[model samples]
Target: MSNTAGRIEPAITDIEQLKDHPAMARLLSWKRDAITEAKFDRDELTITIDRAFIRDACNILKPEFNFLSDVTSVDWLPSEPRFQVTYHLLSHKLKERVRLRVMLPGGQPTVESIISVWPAANFFEREIHDLMGIRFIGHPNMTRILMPDDWEGHPLRKDYPVEGYR
Candidate 1:
């Protein structure tokens, strides 16, 4: 798949082929099992880190991928691992970005907080918790950001009623 820049954007899934990538090389050198999957698509790299190692992965990549661009979640209700937490990181020095993801099961999804790595993650993590009900462990204030404190359910959840839960 070629993009507007005429760059060949092949969806490379093999970790071996992607090891040359700086992020991949750094992560692989730390712990191979920390990353479950790797993909290069649309000129971007996405690495799915194991839930237990998300915090460590962030710490390892912090020096180069210094900017924490965004933190968000997606709910895949019917899927066994029904939730995915995504972190977008940017490297101004290298002029590149890499996405890190962690998959969580349906009931009460939770992952360690990255606020220690990037304090900017504070609000982003709060918003995800408020709207998607995914908890960010160790977050100083995990209270609702966009939704009311008494909100019934995570409004952004796929199983959340369309008309709003009564």
Candidate 2:
């Protein structure tokens, strides 16, 4: 591969500009409505998938992103869609990585579980549920993995008390 050793490209946020990206191309071709947003920043591709189509999107991209690197969540407090669940996928054959995200409303932070696509997601999803309070529908076992069964609230949530919950 030819390399421009010193060249640094600017981030691309426009869908048109990212259409040529492998992950973006595949997802857009499969279901345009599934992708809400996309970005290629610092050599990393992040695709924001609509909550309704997250599972489908994962299934579609599974062939290309054959390895699920991680599954995690971010709490965007005071925001209407207060949570972002992110899945990091790796393609060993392509030697590439991509991130898929799903935004969930604060009132009901729920998303379809991708455990069906990648069984390794079991522990990761359970951890997110235990600490962030985001539920994974269809997860074989959704019980807390990091927190106690009787834990009062999700510890990692932005609204959770700084000190231990009383």
What is the lDDT of every predicted structure here?
0.93, 0.91
Which lDDT tens digits does candidate 1 get at residues 1-166?
A: 5457775656999999999998999999999999999999988899999999999999999999999999999998798899999999999999999999999999878999999989999999999999999989999999999988887788889988888956
Question: Candidates' TM-scores?
Answer: 0.92, 0.91
Where does model 2 exceed 4 Å of error?
A: 1-10
Which pairs clash in the backbone of model 1? none
Worst ten in a row by lDDT for model 2: 1-10
Off by over 4 Å in 1: 1-10
On TM-score, the candidate that comes out on top is 1
TM-score of 2: 0.91
After TM-score superposition, what is the CA distance of residue 52 in candidate 2 from its true location, in Å?
Answer: 0.8
Instruction: Report the lDDT of model 2 for residue 64.
Output: 88
